[model samples]
Target chain A: MRTTIMPSVRILIFFTILTGILYPVGITFVALGIFPYQANGSMVERNGRVVGSELIGQGFTGDRYFHPRPSAIAYDPVPSGGSNWGPTDARMADSVAARRDAFIRKNGVPGDVVVPKEMLFASGSGVDPHISPDAALLQMERVAAARGFDTQKSDALKELVMRCIEPPQYALFGEPRINVLSLNLALDALEKGYPPPF
Target chain B: MITVSELIQLMLYALALFLLTPPLGKLMAMVFRGERTFLTPALGWLERVAYRVSGIDPDKAMDWKGYLWSLLSFNAFGFAVVFLLQFFQSSLPFNPQQLPDVSWHLAFNTAVSFMTNTNWQSYAGEVTLSYLVQMLGLTVQNFVSAATGIAVLLALVRGIAGRSTGSIGNFWADLTRSIVYLLLPLSIILSLFLVSEGVVQTFSGSRTVTTLEGVQQTIPLGPAASQVAIKQLGTNGGGFFNMNSAYPHENPTPFSNFLQMLSILLIPSALVYMFGAMVNARRHAWVVWGVMFFLFAAGVTLSLWSEYTVNAVTGVGGGMEGKETRFGVANSILWSVATTAASNGSVNSMHDSFSPLSGTVAMMNIMLGEIIFGGVGAGLYGMMIFIILTVFIAGLMVGRTPEYLGKKIESFEVRMAAIAMLLPSAGILLFTALASVADAGLAGLNNQGPHGFSEILYAFASTAGNNGSAFAGLTANTPFYNTLLGINMLIGRFGVIVPMLAIAGSLAQKKITPLSSGTFPTDTFLFGVLLTGTMLIVGALTFIPAQVLGPVAEHFLMLNGKVF
Candidate 1:
């Protein structure tokens, strides 16, 4: 029993240190040298102030900005998660109805105008930073109206949204998407200088 | 229901997987047998060092009882260590976030989840656990637990091919070789590649940053690339962050996404060929691989169709809700089916928002024992159980004594095989029943109606099957789910393993008989179909009623244009 049990305990401890401490730390050390910006969290910086991570979603509720997907966690990065509501659930249907109604009223689009499903549905992570290109385009009217932009400004805004559209990853895998933060930042940059103040 | 593009993507994914299986499988066989190969000179020193350090005698073999005890004790130690780490994380080094201790039930759940290689997470990763717990507790279990599965598998394969012997090989030796030669080297290479592709690998704490809308947000950071590499390679599936592979840091580029998806099945797929090599029957391995591929292809076809069809309630096609656009619909559906089929439950899309029929397809994959290139060593063993049952049934029909690989299928072996097969079934059905009736279980539900029922069923199925993906609608942090699911994880993993080991013990003692006209050749296509059929019939018959109540009913409701 001693022979069987003692070696097991010692091996467990040895492997734990090897895998738990040395391996991850060693990898982190190498990553720090080569991919520091990403290894640290992909934090985007502007005007010497740290902005959001390129990978994570942030809350952007103002009508002047193109909204990302509905986040069940309200874009809380710490406790990121989806709504977890099933499609047939009454709560999900009601929430979708409410979001659609609000979106229709806010955007001032016709009642029959087809809304992008991503607008009404919550992302699984609750921190999805991208929305479908169509989802972003659908919100263009509301964002333009809120910014009090004229025809030329609205068209420029449209052009910016088009430019912001990221092609499907590798032109093979994902859907074409527009990063919400990037688009909103571009919106701000269009108005002012490169730093784009709040 | 599937579109042309979706079909193309599914076909391409399947083609790539099948094309790579044979060589990888043969390489794994060589690795297991201690044969000299290309990686031997480089990795052989690491294996010898591991043996020397652990004081494990690689030449000494153990009977089935010794192997089972060592496996159980080793896992028990892991569970204890993980549980203790969760309790003491605040004091642990590298905890830059200053995260506190975890609750008892949740800690128990997390420990068992990782130890069983299920990797189910009831709590969000970023807020609950510090970096120390993630590495020392969870990541360690990811390696050992996966190695444990492979070790058990090698034992079984040896038993099948043993010549009048009771010894099934040294548990410590197999476990060590599995980690040193197979898991460790692969993880190191994959982790480096993932880091190159922008998956995070750092000790830095969460960074506070301003959003474009002027809101201050904290973006969580950790040694994600390392963990993600092993999680997929080992089929562990626990996410470093709450979002799993969907979180771009965990899976940043399309190339990385493809790599991660490929890694999930790489070992499990190779193990089939390894089984053939160990048994000296390479043709039989191809037969089993064919069966698994066919089942996988069928599941993906159903899922693609279900996902592509326009929603009845929303009147929208391309089921984009709860899916990351970066992984689009086609890739997401492929991943959904592949993850479940492999019992590697890391997901790029939320299964909860998948159309009802599609969600059912994912559930069916797990419920069918996840043997379509299932988890590393666990999948082939699970498939072997069904193969045993298939041969036994065929023997009964022919009025002849049943034999597999020259070993007779006696009452004891059949009894053990039956127990091995039925244990997970019991875990799924019994727990689902308990949770359905209990107020505590009802409280965890996020949706109402049949979809809600499916959420509970899916949780139990995922745990009991040792596949960790969840429907995402159930709040499973409470003690009821935490403890119950923990029990399920244990029963699901070991219940099958122990009985399978006992069968190996019995089989190892049998003398080989010469093949005659009566001998049933398992290497044939007909036998492969029989094996697959037996698996599906057993699964479908056991779980169909529950399925009808959940996803099936929901599917019908959608067709009626009625949201729950």
Candidate 2:
């Protein structure tokens, strides 16, 4: 005689709801209450409108702001990606050559602007938020020309970029990289807009 | 010589983590076990209502077939969800700004990366994912998928330990309670702690901040603290910020860094205790943990010794090529040990910057098959299987039947253990040889020395160990690598996992052999010698040829200043 202990279908749904819906929702809710700002993607807001999330990279073409590494995603948020391009892939080599050429043309920068490897190569995810200050300075000339400002104004902007460059972590964890999204946003605010909150 | 401060900091981190993790991990273990405590009762009640409405089995202990079906089907569903999110993120609601469709390769990479727990993300978290995608898809999957692995491992452990038992714990129950009571509560606490340390936890859009130098910048923001909590707790090493824990928004202070470190190891370290508890021999867990801790300490000592020597004395201008000065020697060594100690791939210090001998130690840790306090669910089972094999070998010496924790070790059990051990070794060697022979792998080499050979060896070891951290010097991730390492991770993780479960199933049916005069002494010093020999002879010998070609040759080349 085999006695049966069949789990009720009701119990299965019950467990699913508990595990799937209620659990995640509950954690999210608690997170929202305690740290409302970061709970919502660590976004910063001005004038009651959403801007961008602080943790993500953004498009930066404006000269006033420091430029991020060239991205394959072109700053696309969904479907984040990397080049996944190997060193010897002909296509990867062509892309690098094209980027180097474009870099030369933009600021009439020398054939050797001493571009950072990160700047030359697309980031693994392609949406990198930081750029080397050297990469930023290379762009400083063009931004000043576009704005009809003197080199001093650009130098000031460069100083601003310098201010934003986060020091190597605890003085040794990684190389210094300037957060592009942050730098550009500050540039926008610096030109007779509301001063950014430090 | 290893500095006293560096060693002290590492141990203090370990002790603090040890003290804090157990209660939280025990709670999580119990949650996974179907004990309704804290948040579980309410969640269970809600589940009851849903089950009644949907006519589903909330209590069914899914048989192997059913379990496999549910797992695969659900995973497929996750793939679809992520794909759909990528394709439709712009059109989707809650996206403040418009972004375009995802490229095909990146989407595939993200899908597999998350599903595999490699979480080797190429995308920046704040820029790419919409709030909805992060919340509804990635975050949700992060919790559930993690719970799923823990549930599966727990079931197999029960099967192995049980005598003549046909039942493993119910998967649905295990998954349900584990998330409700374990992952959620711990995440909440961990997230709050991080938030207090100034890690962002907001929905407000990006803010422009004027620095003291009067420069303005917009800081990108998102739901970082929440993801960071689960990423570490689950041993899934996805970073919300591209720089990982080094990101200011995610790891704002030293306190946050400590907490992040603690979260990554909480479960893995505690499972030693859990295994001890489950097997009814507390000493078994302690002994395993003891051996792992000592071995882990030794690896750290060697790696740090190599690193400091290079930094303080290297005549070469590029010795510490890409290290962050802020992290310095202490943090760098600490991260090396932490990343090696567990299978978590998240790294604060770049392994590429590691000196020659230090890099070898880091690589060697993975070569040991991650039995030194390894992955979240897979780690303990890995070590336990080794113990079973050790006992069997002891039995060979005594000419008596081997028994472990009361269960008799038979020929069938030993075969399964052998299969588990052989599978990963074969996967690595065959794949390494294939890669070494292939032009695709050879083309990726940049360092014009023997160190370059080590890059290939490290790649295979990382994949086979199921540790996601990389040397980064090797430019892997092309179709050649993506495909090869993908298969390696699949085989290395599931290949060993399935065999371990099979051993469990075999042992479960065997009669308990009581201790008698004929029984071999397992806990004695004789067994220790045999076990150490097995680790060296079997484990060491398997990768020796590969190591010689990669690191040893590279070492000679670096010394001679020429390529062979």
Q: What are the models' TM-scores? A: 0.96, 0.73
Model 2 spans with C-alpha error above 4 angstroms = A1-198, B1-5, B21-73, B87-99, B122-133, B203-219, B311-326, B442-448, B521-533, B552-564
Candidate 1 regions exceeding 4 Å error are: A108-112, A141-156, A193-198, B1-5
TM-score of 1: 0.96
What is the CAPRI rating of model 1's predicted complex? medium
Quote the RMSD, in angstroms, for model 1. Answer: 2.2
Best candidate according to TM-score: 1
- Candidate 1 per-residue lDDT, tens place, B100-174, comes to 899999999999999999999886788999898999998899999999999989999989999889999889888
lDDT of each: 0.84, 0.62
The candidate maximizing DockQ is 1
Lowest-scoring 10 consecutive residues by lDDT in candidate 1 chain B?
B1-10
Q: What share of the true interface contacts does candidate 2 keep?
A: 0.10
DockQ (Cα-based) per candidate?
0.59, 0.09
Q: How much does candidate 2 score in TM-score?
A: 0.73
Give the DockQ (C-alpha) for candidate 1.
Answer: 0.59
